[model samples]
Structures are given as C-alpha cells and as structure tokens.
Target: MNITAIKDKYERPILSLRITVTNRCNENCLYCHHDGMITSEDEMNADEIYRICKIAKNIGVQKIRLSGGEPLLRKDIVEIVNKIASLNFKDISITSNGTLLEKYAKDLKDAGLNRVNISLDTLNPETYKKITTKNLANSAKRGVLKAIEVGLYPVKINMVLMKGINENEVKDMFEFCKKNRIILQLIELMNSENCDDEKFSKEYHYNLDSISEKLLNICDDVKTRDFMQNRKKYFIDGGEIEIVKPIDNSDFCANCTRLRITPDGKIKPCLLRNDNLVELISYIRKNESDEKLKEIFIKGINKREPYTI
Candidate 1:
C-alpha cells in the first residue's frame, strides 16, 4: 500500500476521518448537530462502512472517529468497530450519547475502540431531560464509569455550553470530572442546519471567549493542540479541561485536519456547508474498484475549503 497524506487546497493535511454511522439517535438534544449529516434512512451497512474505512486507511487517514445522532443506535455497532479495528488506524474513537454504553462498553473496548467521548451537558437529571427530552443522566454516568472500568482510557465528557442553560455547571462539572478521573470538554454550541433552528441557536449559543479568564484562573498550564482542531487543554489539580471553540471561527477551519462522511456515504468536505460533498454510495453499489474509490476520496479532499472564509 503506497499510502500518502491527502492535503487540501489550503495545504492542510487530512489525517482524521469523522464518520456518522447513522442518524438514528435515542435522544433528541435540542442542540444536536447530527455531525452535519442529513438525517435519512439511507445509512451505509456495516460492510459498506468497513470498505470506506479500509480505503481511508490506505490513503493516510490516521484517526477515525465514529459519530452519529447516536452511533449506538445501530445494533451492529460492535461489528462495525471490529471491522475498523482490523485497519489498525492510529486512533479509533466514538462520540456517543452514552445511554446504551453501559451494556456495550466492554464489547467496544474488545473490538479495538481506543477512547470515547460521551455527551453529558448537565449533570442534573432534570435539566438533562429538559435539554434532551430524555431522563437518562444516571445511565450516562454509569456508562462513563463502565467505559473506564473496561480500560477505555481517557474517557472524555463533552458538555455543550448554552446560555441560560447548563453554563453555570462549569465549576461543578470540573469538580465532578476531577473526582471521576475523566476529561471534561466544554464545547461551544455551533449553528448548523441539524440544530433545532436559527432562533434556538442564536438564543442558546454561548461564547467561550467570555469565560476564558475564568478557565485560565482555574488552570495555569494551558496546552493548545493547534494543528489538531485548535483544541485547548488545561490541567488543574489532576483534572484536565479541553475547550472546543465554535467551528464558525476561521481558526478552527484553518487548522482542521479532518473530513466528514455522512451516514449515507457522502463525502462532506466541510461541515459548515453542504454544497461540496462528493457522492460515494452509488459508486460503491456499482462495485467500484478500490482505486476508483481512492480517486473519489482524492476528489473530496480537493474540494475542501475553509468554510469560515
């Protein structure tokens, strides 16, 4: 396999592949972005998904993160993970709502999942229900604990900061993560078509810029993963905090090394815009050669542009 890194027009290396396995989710979070995927019943089967990942690995994509409205909604999730694991990518992770994780954490770990990022916006069960219309906060917590017990190292909790909502839980969440020995990621809400509406995003989107001072005060040693999504990490009293800025920021696009694949097997070059996706499902259905698929991947990489610009 003569693998070479695929660089976009802006010269950014494509090293990460974020695949939305399915749009079917168990919880309906008001702020869910659906990973910029168009929700439909046209999801790729496990074999189709594995083939894509195999082709991806052949072309220098190092990290693969399985995401969805909720990836666990797919019953064959473990088989999907095992197939991807066979590729031996540098890192293979999943972003899940964690409701069903308690039952599948061990299976996922055994299937070669490196880490997990579970969405836990508010620790309060009532508030969680209000935000997601699901009262599974206790289940999510147990899933996190189970993931840790099963050796899913560095279990990360993703909390979306929303104004007049869960914003006040920063300190409490930090404390909770510190006690639990897990990583806490504070994500700034993004305005995507998958969101409830423009009104809801505008009303709830809280800028992390306002709380930078408070974050710095809590942690002195700040580390920035500049080339890898511009994520900032801070460590305080053995607890780690990562701040994920909004994608609308040009800096986020400028440093992005990732590309996305929607559940239906379309190549989404940019998350903020839906105009440039290269279709792959039809070609795969036609039993296209791996080389032909590789060309499509290259074409998709070429189509990538900074959406914020």
Candidate 2:
C-alpha cells in the first residue's frame, strides 16, 4: 500500500491519531476535560480498535496515542497495544494518570509501547488529593518510577499549572523529573466549556508567560517541534521541560496534526469542539469495506479546523 498523507483544507497534514479507549477513569481531577468526549460505555474492543488503526496506518498516520479518562483502566489494554503494535507505527504511546503503571508498564513495554505520558500535578500528597479527590499520590509516583525502570524511554510527566494551588511546585516537580531523567511538560490549565468545571478554569488558570520568561533566561538550548503545535522545548542544566500553552494560542491550533477518535468511536476533528464529530463505528460494525472506512476518514479530515482560529 502506497502511503499518501492526508491533509485538511488548512493544509495541516494528519500525522498523528489519538484514540480514547475508554471514558471510565479512577481519578476525578479538578481540570479533567475528559478529552472533550461524552461519557460512553460503548467502547470499541481490541479487534475494532485494531481495524481503526490499520486504516489509519494505511493513510500514512505514523503515530498512535492511546488516551482515556484513564487508558490503563481497560482490562484488554495489553491486547490493544499488541494489536496496534503489529501495524508497525513509528510511535505507540499512552496518556495515563499513572496509578496503574507499576502493574502494567512492563507488559505494555513488552507489547511494543514506545513511551508514556503520566499526569502528576503536584508532588505534595495533600495537594494531589485535593486536586484529584483521591489519595493515590504514592501510587502515581511509584507508577512513574516503574515506567522508567521498565525502559519506557523519555517518560513524560504532565503537570497542569494551577494558580493558588500547585503553581509554586514547578521547581520541585522539575527536580523530580530531572532526578528521574524524565521530560516534564508544564501545561496551562485549559479554559474550555467541556471541562469538569467552568469556574475551576476561571479560578485556577495560571498564566505561563512569567514561567516561560524565566525558563528562557536559564535554558541551555531551545528547540521548536513544528508538528506538535510549534511548542518550545527548553533544556536547562541537564534537565528538559516543555511548555504546553494551548489556551487561546493561534500557533498551537495552526500547527496541529492530530486526528482524534472518541471512546464511542467517532472521528473528532477538533479537541475543543463537540459539534463536528463524524460517526465511524456504525459502519465498522456493519462490516463495511476498508474503502468505505477510508471515505469516512476522509470526510472527518475534511471537517478539520483550528478551534482557536
């Protein structure tokens, strides 16, 4: 099969596919956006997910990211990873809250997972419980270590900066990531209607400008990733940090190359909007041809647009 890269009308080539394996999560964080997906129990099985990924690979999407309310919650996660890995994607990763990494990281790695991104907002147990409404900080921390030990290279930690909360813990979190040789991603609290709470964003959205300026002065080097919303990665004293400022950023939207699949199996064109989803699983359930699935994929790609712009 000749891989032909698909592009939207905005000329952004689709290079990455993000699939939400399930909406069920163990933690209820204050800033959980649920990946802009409605709660659904009808998640696609491993075989169905494999079919979607196979079609995606045929269309030249080199990267596949498994996400969830918590992707590790799925019992068949290892099987899912094994199936996707067989497609031979350039990258296969997952975004998890990290409480289950200690138990599953080794199996996932052995199944061909390239890396992982774990969410750890604060190292302080009290604050972690306050934010996530769960006292599993120790479990999450251990998961991080286990992932590193299992040889998941470049294990990234996602810390969403929140004002009057964990914002002051930046230096502490960076130190931990540095000690673990992990990449730290400082994410700005997203201001979206799809979030768990609208007032939560208004109350906690910490401006990253001040933080970015500080890192700019001390950084040893800087590199821009064009495919990933042109976000800047900073290297400081043998430690690495990446700033993810997705709120109200035109450049972030302009350079996005990701196509999302909701837990219930719809192609989501934009992360911040729920109106333009193209139904996909219905045809797949109907046992449609691969060419028919390809047409549905193209239809969803045509609907792609920058939410911020």
Candidate 3:
C-alpha cells in the first residue's frame, strides 16, 4: 500500500482494496454461491476492521470497499463504514444484494458511505424467483430506488449477465440506466472452480465478443472504468453502460488493480485465484513492521500473473 518502492513483480503499484465484511447472504443465487466455506462465520469484529482501515489509510490505500455475503447483513456495517470513513480513505463504498439496502441506505449514507453497488441480475419477477429461489423483486427494486433517493449518485447495479438467463435484459438495463441515471454494469459471469455444476451450464458461456457487439448497438457509448487511474469518472453517454469481461485467464490479468477481502477475513489477491492472506491477529501480534506489512500487500500484488486464453 505504501507508494514508495512497493511495486509488484510487474512493477504495478497497488491502490484500491475491496474488503468483505460478512459471509451470510440472504439469498443464495444458485450459480454464484459455493458449497465449500467455513460456515461458522468467525472473523474480525468492528474494532478489527477499524484498526485495519487505520493501518491501510496510513500507508496509501485510499479507496476501500465493503463487500461480502451482503455487507448490509451485518448489523455493525453502519458503524464499520463510519469508522472506515473516519480514516484517511478517499472513497468508501459497499457491495450488497440490494434486498436489505432499502432499509439501510439513509443510515449507510449517514455513516459516510460514498456509493453502493447492488447485485441484481434479473428484472423479471419469474426469472428472479427462478434464479434466487425467492421473490425479492419488489424489495430489491425498492432498494435500488432507495439508494438513488439518498443521492448515492450513479448508483451502480452489478448485473452478472448470463446467456439464456438475464442476458436479454442488456438493452432493458441500459434503457433503465439512461432513464434513472443509474450506472448499469453488465459483467460477464465468472468461471470459478464451482462454476460447472448444474448451476453453471454451457449455455451460459456468453462470449464477451458477441455480447459487446450487441451491447454497442443498445448503448450510446460504453466506457471501461479504470482502477487507480482517475482519468475518467463515470462513463457518460446518451446511455452510459460499463462492460466488465471475466478474466480467469486473460492477457492483462497482470495489471488487475483491485483486491478482494472475503467476509471471514480471507483476503483474496484476485477473485479468480485463491492465494495468500493476512490473518489479522497473527499479523498484528507478530509485530510486523510497516515495511513488512507493505510486503504482505506487495506479495499479493506480485503474485499477479499473465492470463491465458
């Protein structure tokens, strides 16, 4: 995190960090949920996140995101966000399912949250029920609206578009984004270790090339949101849409800038790959010097390898 000589093997400097706060999600979207996890839900408490955020801010990690099974599910999220905000962070955001956001958006905003991203893959009620095994369409929709109401400008909707599923909503999502001034992010479904089960079918491949072609037709423009570099903010157009292709094995994986921290205190260097982590107490108790902690951050950064086809 320190900007000095802390360069990855590829020489890329780390900046943005994504932190997951909880593991218990309300809805288990069939495809994305995994069977393997320490379900006990044991991790750092509010005080721990506060201390970590303080350490992160001291070093040069300005942007921190709260993620999880659904960060809002944690009753202490508001306090956590408030504490993180009280740090030296330049941006504080949270990723949630939106089912619980409607009830907490105002409180979250009051806690110094700058933005929020909700996981909403389908708009059709039937498809939603089929996908999530629950009828949360109304409440989820309300959550998005509530986020918008609180001036969470450019409220982002993280839509994991899959073929034969919610892919057709591409155009509809852009139209919705244009009208509501929301940022609709059409992200390709990832190929995880557990992706091949009944949940992830071949019909869901959804080649980015084809999807982008069709999306360009609907979107007035599509912009790639760069991490770390702030050359551009939200991509603006008659219809602003962002396309994020999956990167399990892609050429530019070496430059992947974002880091994810799972709810149970497991820090994933990259979403596609399982790697090293920072055990909170162990790391602190070791009396690890600032430079060594920066090394831990850099070790993950250096692990970044080139992606293959």
Q: Candidate 3, residues 87-169: lDDT per residue as tens digits?
A: 75778888888999889999989889999888888788898888788899889989999999997765888888777888778
Clashes of each: 0, 0, 0
Candidate 1: residue 64 lDDT (0-100) = 96
What lDDT score is found at residue 1 in candidate 3?
36
lDDT of each: 0.89, 0.93, 0.69
TM-score of each: 0.96, 0.98, 0.86
RMSD in angstroms between candidate 1 and the native structure over all alpha carbons: 1.4
Alpha carbon lDDT at 278, candidate 3: 45
| Candidate 1 segments whose C-alpha is farther than 4 A from its true place | none
- Please identify which of the two predictions, 1 or 2, would achieve the higher lDDT against the true structure: 2
Compute the lDDT of residue 223 as modeled in candidate 1. 92
| Segments in model 2 whose C-alpha atoms lie over 4 Å from true places | 196-198
Higher-scoring candidate on TM-score, 1 or 3: 1
Model 2: number of backbone collisions: 0
lDDT of 1 by residue, 133-180 (tens): 998999998998899999998899999998998999999998998998
Answer with 2 or 3, whichever has the higher TM-score.
Answer: 2
Best by lDDT: 2
Question: What local lDDT score does residue 234 receive in model 1, on the 0 to 100 scale?
Answer: 88
Cα RMSD of all models vs. native, in order, equals: 1.4, 1.2, 3.4
